[model samples]
Target: MFDFVRRHNRILQFILLLLIVPSFVVFGIQGYNKYSEGRNHVARVDGQDISQSDWDAAHRNQVERMRAQMPGVDVKMFDTPEIRQRVLEDLVRERVVFAAARDLHLSPTEERLDRLFKTDPQFAGLRNPDGSVRKELLAAQGMNSALFAQRLSQDLAMRQVLSAIGLSAFAPESVARAAVDAFYQRREIRVQRFDAREQLGRVQVGDADLQAYYDDPRNAARFQAPESVTMEYLVLDLPAVERGISVPEDDLRKYYGENASRYEQPQERRASHILVKAEAGGPADARARAKARAEALLAEVKKNPAGFADLARKNSDDPGSAAKGGDLDWFSRGAMVKSFEEAVFALKKGEISGVVESDFGYHVIQLTDVRGGERRGFESVRAEIEAEVRKSLAQKRFAETAEQFTNLVEQEDSLKPVAERLHLTLRRVEGFTRGFQPKEAKAEDAAVLASPKLAELVFQSETLAGKHNSQATEIGASQMVAVHVSAHQPARKQALADVREAVKAAVTQARAAQAARTEGEARLAQWKARAPDAASLPAAVTLSRARSQDLPKALVDAVLKAPAEKLPAWVGVDLGGDGYAVVMIEKVLPADVADTGPIDKVRQQYAAMWAGAESEAYLAALRKRYKVEITGKAKAAEEPAGAASK
Candidate 1:
């Protein structure tokens, strides 16, 4: 299972990205050996500490994000030395980018950062429709103002540095055109597939073979079960705390009086228009004709006010509102173009206006209805004001209380001390496995149990033996849990008697796969000898590298690279556990270059590659400019396989 981390590119790259990418860290002028490593500091950049808490939180989030993307992925697969090292490298690289950004004074500006807090997709999901960040939503995401602001500033600053580096990347026009021409060059080929699964009927396995295969150490992981624990935990719900606190009327009334305008709803009006065709630079009389037509429609609508919508449908040039019988829904002031806005706002409800000229054309305006803005009475919005005040007070109260909670849990043997002191319930979560299987795991237990860091601590030898309370794990901004293992289940291998049928099936599959590979190789050898123009086989189909087709990705990649030195070249792929597939390359084709290809497409691709190189080179330069020091256990994990942007 540890092989998953080695195979996952994200983990592999983070472990070795630093040495491979080569970047810098800025800090005070100090000799390397003079610096002492602090336990809290995971890695020191210049003189600043990248706190251990931050590192653990980042690793936890990365694992959770990966699990979200790939539901079948095992969490324990990421708990390897290689992955930890990679995560450190990612931090180091990020620091380097940030250092460079600081050197350029490219830190996120206040306005830009505010805009991001309100609109950047990651953080923006927590925003109200009006673009105000929701504190409750932010809390649910485990973010407070200070943490969010700091992270966002660093993220934006790094982007600023990278964008500046990428600015230097460009290609000559000729180079771009040639690259594009190569891209459009196409290839076509036919494949003859010999499926391994189809050949399974020819093979057989015995009981001896099954026992021998099961005994192999290489397959031990397949039979090993992960250690699990049934834990007892306690939670202090923040919302419940808020519910208990009652805000005085005087405070709510004071707040409302001080910010009365905030409670006011702005006036809104709805209008629909029938546009008459006109062109600013068309024939001389076109504008005049459009104005005359609008005037005629206006007089007719004023004569029969009820037929305004019918006239709009029959002759309105504005197709969007025409289909809806000229209903423009509603709009506040400054919502429409200046000329149209002024004309619509000037009219009374259900009033028809004279010809109103605007950018689109001359318009016959009709005012639908108007809503007058007003301030709500104190009674009308008391609940809203109270809820707001309570949330604000609760946040403050939580901050003050969290420190006490943290301190209490540190000195206690169990969560009982803290729960009893705070008048909170001691919650028990049972049968919690490291990897949360839906069938075995409880949905309500996910927030605490799904936390990788918390799970690691809960399952640690000390915690499992009931020596100490697991460290208080913060589930979100307002909630924390400290777990005590009530029951432990040590992982052990099943006896051969219990898994005989499973072992027999595995042995049969392995033997069948071997038989398929043997058959594929023999057939491939014979086909090479014959050297026929074409070989007809079962389940045969044609494919091309540059064309969209429905085939397994592994097969596509294998066939595309099959040596085409000779036409109808052959290749074989071992699908591992699925069997072998023999493929024949039927043709080698070139890109279409008769006419000049899409030069812009090739230029964009070249520009992207060029930008990445430029950015990497820029980081390497920063490494030379800044004084960097690796401390503590970080020395062993400095190498990282650098990742690239698309």
Candidate 2:
């Protein structure tokens, strides 16, 4: 409990602040802090205050990471309240975890930090050509050697704490084996259902009954339609703009000529060589021996330059291309190391180059075939260019048309007049509630449903009273809508006759559920009172073997979630219609039969759970360790209670 409280301390603070302060006070604080403090601080864990800087940085980092992952995310995507809340919660969680780590007094050693830094793929992949870590990458992630070391230490410490608690609390073999067996075991059910569709034809209603049913307050609600609007509007299309603009053939030709390289494939060569490194150190005699071996290989390559490919496979330090007869597959200029690229590009066709020195040591090169490249002709790509030109024209035309529509709507003061003049079609919609779809509107009818402004206008009382012109809304680039209220009908109650069957069925379900609960409870109570009377166990309560987790998913969930120490708790839940269940946890068999397999598996599962728990506790402990305060508007700025609970 304490740990949980600690983990959610920031949330708790916000909740308390909201519950204690007035809304206007909260608003005032927010306004004052917005200008004075610059950014309204949400909360502080331990001594480290969580400022707007922290929030913004966290949010930006999250968005950037998401952008990296999705590649096509737009700025508008981040504008939603849901996204904002998520970002805020993540920032809060980070502070909580950091605070907890501080409270634990757990730190990683220098050696561990060094190992992490050197081995982490992200850091390792950012190394310079000479095999040194990049300064910029480290700086971007907000880490120096010391901060990175601390991060590693915190990670290690948290893992240690979690493992200690979770691993030590492993379930017994009897517990795990039973759980696994019960879960993996399957049962087939033969089911039959009397569906409403099948009975609907049999459910007949006379004229008088139907009219009576429709008059019923409860039944009448079914006929209540969502608010709707009818609209007439103009649309501008992108294709129209594209058609009006033109790019000359001369210009296209000039573009192709100036950028000829873009159309030409680079020339590539396949070559291979034996690498003998001078960097391999040894005793004086060993060094001399290696040098002599390299010299002998050099002499052999010189003797038969064509044999270089065969020699490379037999002896080359470059494992990347050692197979396939040491063939370094076709590579363009700048594809190879500077030394290698220069050497290979300089060699004449079919000529073997002298030994070349590079980071990989010395390499004798074979000049393989250099396939000359070619530039593509314009005729082959003319169609593609033409299509591009056409699309561009269309887009431009669409924008102009849209602007003209907007101007017409602004001047004429009514969408109906403009639409009629332009010979555009007028559409009428019905059966729409406040949020319901208009009768004739489809999801793709962006002109009607997509505009936020039009949606508001359609719903306004003045518009319903027929005072204002229809609303003009933009759903797509070239699609616009004008919506006006046609008819208004407020919600009404359904008559009892209209919903008589439904009411009867509902009442029957409630009665049946009550009956089941009453019977189940009585039976359960009787069994509890008659201790050790195995024969007295209700015959209706069938005997079955079930692991702790093997009970009905819903049943197990309800049982485990309760205060288990105070077990023998009874719970009743409605199971559709009048069906209901009342469950009684008869007993809890003690855990027995400890074994490594079960313990290890259970330990792994619990490790994750315990770590989260401990992290939470550690955070609370930190608050006590360091007096932290969040005051005024910042406190009220938190998400709603229960909003971030999940």
TM-score per model over all chains: 0.53, 0.49
What overall lDDT goes with each candidate model? Answer: 0.69, 0.53
Q: Put down candidate 1 lDDT per residue, 160-260, tens digits, no spaces.
A: 88787697678777887666544443435554555656766876877778788779999877776566678777665577568658988999999899989
Weakest ten-residue segment in model 1 by summed lDDT: 637-646
- Candidate 2 structure quality by residue, lDDT tens digits, 1-646: 4554455444433322222111111112223224324445665544444566555555565565556446675654675556655665554444444444445666677776666656755444444565554555445444455543444455565455445554455545565556544333322111112223333334444556555545666755565433344533344345434545567898678767776787786788877666776563446575555556666787898888767777888887678776766678788888888998899999977777766766656677777778857777898776666667668666656656666666666666556776665555555555543444444555555444545545555555555555445445565556665555555555444455556666555444444554554555565465446533433332223112244323355444554443434444445443433233445544444333232245567546545555566656765564465555544132333332222211
Model 2 worst lDDT run, 10 consecutive residues: 20-29
Off by over 4 Å in 1: 1-24, 27-190, 199-204, 246-386, 420-425, 431-444, 497-502, 529-535, 538-572, 591-646
RMSD of each candidate relative to the true structure: 13.8, 12.7
